[model samples]
Target: MQAEYGGDLTQITDLDLLAFDFNPALRMRKFIGESKSGSGKSAPKALDRMIWQRGLRAFVGAEAAELTINSKVTEQNRKFGRELGVSVQTLSDLSRREEALLMAEVEESGSHGAAAFALVEWVRKYTKSEPELEVIFRFLRSKVWFLDSFTAVKQTISVIETLSKQWVVGHEDDHKKAVRWLLAEAVSVFSLMLVDICSEARLRPRFEFDAFVAARLADGVVPSSEMKQLSKSIDKFIAGLLVAAKATPAVRTGAMGAFDPVPPAYADSFAELAWRLSRWVRASDLPRQIDFLAHERIGLNRPVPTMAAQRIQLSNLNFQHSVSLVCAFLRGHAALSPDASETLLNLAVQPEETMSDAVPSDADVASPPPLALKRPGSGADEFRGQDYLDFNDPD
Candidate 1:
């Protein structure tokens, strides 16, 4: 864009709150916002802001705009805004939304926000005094959103295959460095997990959580469709063994099936929610859900989450969907059983460990843990768990 224009877009695109989500058509659905505080004469007026914002919506190709001001929004002004395709947000509206999101565990400090700024300062300070720190800091910046989310993430994901090794090699000498370094690592991991999640949706035409999830385990080693077929083959082979063991007088069918892996913790309690999620992904609600996730992130933390994605490649629908999926999952987290929560914590709760190790080599990723394939002894009613796939499948 810079080369095409012969100038940096940094100045022209300064319209506040230009957030976006991915779609197949334009490949982006953008929301622009303009905000001002205080109702004094010197302060920007609501009508004026909306007028300019409407123009900006066209200039940047945004589909929506929100104009926020301290003054009361009159009916006439609201009508004009509606005609102009910009929505109005008063201070009270923002407050109510924030109140809704307020949680005991959420800190006053921005969610992973201040840490990023501090790391930027720390890096600048170190590099100015120590020339040797240049390469490391550059590498670090390449991996982090410190330089900004869009460009940096593009660079990071392209080289994501080597991310883990690079992380293992980085410095973590002092307390501050270690903490900041680890935070960066976690953010990168967040990006990886996000990418893998989307990758599943991209690789296959149809949507099924288990198939893509299996590919995720493969660590991007095998095509998702192939992995799904491979898993089916494995299950069939195991089922044949189950029948064979029953034919032998000495052998017990249950003993032959003893090797069946236990379902992941909370697989039962999570079955309903997980099934809902899969259905939503495959349903019309997905676009709306993604839109809500994009806008809600801005409402949740002004700059924390969006900074990691803003102006990044629009083709990164996987990242966007993964983010929305994770947000949806986390939103329902409280409803999970306590043991399930503990299992999640013990699992890769940290951003750094979620898809922590980068894409695997030619070596295959293990298939998703299969549910117990019932042999002859148990009735279909006795069988239960996460395998409740589609409406067509026997419940």
Candidate 2:
């Protein structure tokens, strides 16, 4: 069998090696060997002849037989032998100490030996440190052994951070209270995101108010009726911001920063809401408001418009509304009065009846089961006969 692209060949004969010369500009190299069929008696000798003719720098024979000096056939083997004057050895033989020594000497004298040795030394020096070795090991392990999904990694990191915080704080009442409030606020915002707003313009403001409600809930504050009213006003203000963003001339129809001219009344309303919420947020009892605001901005949910045009129109508006709500609260905090802030905090912190515990009215109660029938009808008669049957009956 003939092998291509660096393969071992053995045991064939009666062949002629033809070297073809091509144009130097073409840069082509070619070797052709041809063998003819012969008698079975001559076949063995033919095999020996072929083996002797095609000797290679690295000769791998089927039976691991050593080639005699006279048996060297190909110019490649002759060149290899002349360069090192080394005896050919199988890889298994070279793995042994004695043969390995001879092989090592041969490798040292080989054409690429110096370059290979330099590479080995370079790698040893550069990768000897613990950190370097660890990095290499990790890279190798990642590519060749371990496979991890990014989603799983992210989830694992989140879990680790959460668990670490919980462990550090343990079962402290204050920590538990904080966790409960956070959960409640998350649920509230999630609920608001699911709410269906009738007007497209109303969506951004509604989302903004939801964010504030979420922040208050996180602070362990129950929103009052006034707070709810203020949230609605804030939503309207955000809607106005959207309208202003839409009016900007430089803003692309579907690109960012299109909104620029918020209505004065809407801006005023937003400022008022921000001023009120900021005071509550800055109070000692609600110090986590900044964190809540950051989280809300990062996590704000946008509603999908029913059409492409609607989506393009709403995108910049939504963004403007979100920015206005956050910026107003951040900038207005210093202007709030101490007494007003204290009152807002007290209102937020005050215990209020939860929806979970709200009592049902009398109308909500089910009426007593309809009075039982005094007489049996056709439907009841079928079962009535069976009910009257007693154990005393005989076949």
Candidate 3:
């Protein structure tokens, strides 16, 4: 049993120390040492490491983090350590623990805390082998983490819309699967990053999820318009193809039916949809989303119910679509809005409703099942429609 990320000095935290306490009159206590670690002989950098560890503890969802250095920390650094909940120690502490009695205590608790992250690592791992998809893979790994959820999702949609032009028509199932798999993984990655960022922001009195997200997405500057023409071109390019269909093609042909019949919550354009999603996220509801995703991952252990995808005709998928299916659940329930939900559909221009009966009917999907069952003791019977919040309803 190795410590999680224990040997990697490059990581922000240390999970190796295995802490313990002794008490004769009561049960002995043992603590697993977990924290992000960075090295610096200079006091200021050490403080920065402490701060980074604080976020890592929350991101990894660890009970505690410890930062140990070769030299003692400054008096001021010690002060912040106490406030930040990091345990700071020097090299000499190991000298006090060369005896067998201490080893017995350490063994009693066995604080290797892999449970915190073992769940996520187990559910899914994507293998990107297609030469065309290399650009998509690189963007996900390199760019998505640094972005806000909205922009991250938007960029995801945009990139696929661009790459998908080369896809053969018969591969619509493959396309939808790929699109869904990417979005599902994106949500998981983005949510985990959100946990790290949100945990750090909690230290400030004025922190807001929206503002923090907006600032980060902007990266201290205005957002870009470089992709606007690209998005417009693809949407227009496909709209023309839908009209030129001389004979009925497969349900998946022409403009991708994957994104078509824009959900009632969408604003008909990418920019409008972005604004709608920006307004829907709030801190209080954010945890519910996290818990929602966690339980969602938990549910993947079982096989999906029959006819689950309904008219969309999605087959009972494996680990790849698990997180994304949960996200689509949230979108249907109005947790993640429709505009953002399109991200799960791979962000292509949807075909016109008249063009395809293969996709879910506009009215049929107008009400997907709610995100959850009614609570333990509540008799609330309100219908949670796709039009629940009434964002883009044409009144």
Highest-scoring model, TM-score: 1
State, as a TM-score between 0 and 1, how close model 1 is to the true structure. Answer: 0.41
Residue 51's lDDT in candidate 3: 83
The global Cα lDDT (0 to 1) of model 2 is 0.30
lDDT of 3 at 101: 35
Ranking by lDDT: 1, 3, 2
Candidate 2 lDDT over 1-395, as tens digits, reads: 33333437764542233222222121112233333334344443323433543453123221112323222235565455344332333323335854645544333221124643453344335444535343432332122111122122222223222322332222445333332222222322221211111111122354565444333322212334445555556656665675777755333333332232222223334334433322221111121232232222111111111231121222232222332333333234223222222221221110122112358577535634222112222242111222121222353
Would you estimate the TM-scores of all the predictions?
0.41, 0.13, 0.32
lDDT tens string, model 3, 210-308?
Answer: 444443443322332433334456666665676576535552254443322222222122222222322222322332233323222221211112222
Better of 2 and 3 by lDDT: 3
lDDT per residue as tens, model 1, 109-220: 2323445346556656766555534444555543242223323333333332232233322333543343334233333333333332333333334446554343333332
Candidate with better lDDT, 1 vs 2: 1
Candidate 1 error regions (>4 Å): 1-4, 8-10, 13-15, 18-29, 103-156, 159-165, 168-395
| Top candidate by lDDT | 1
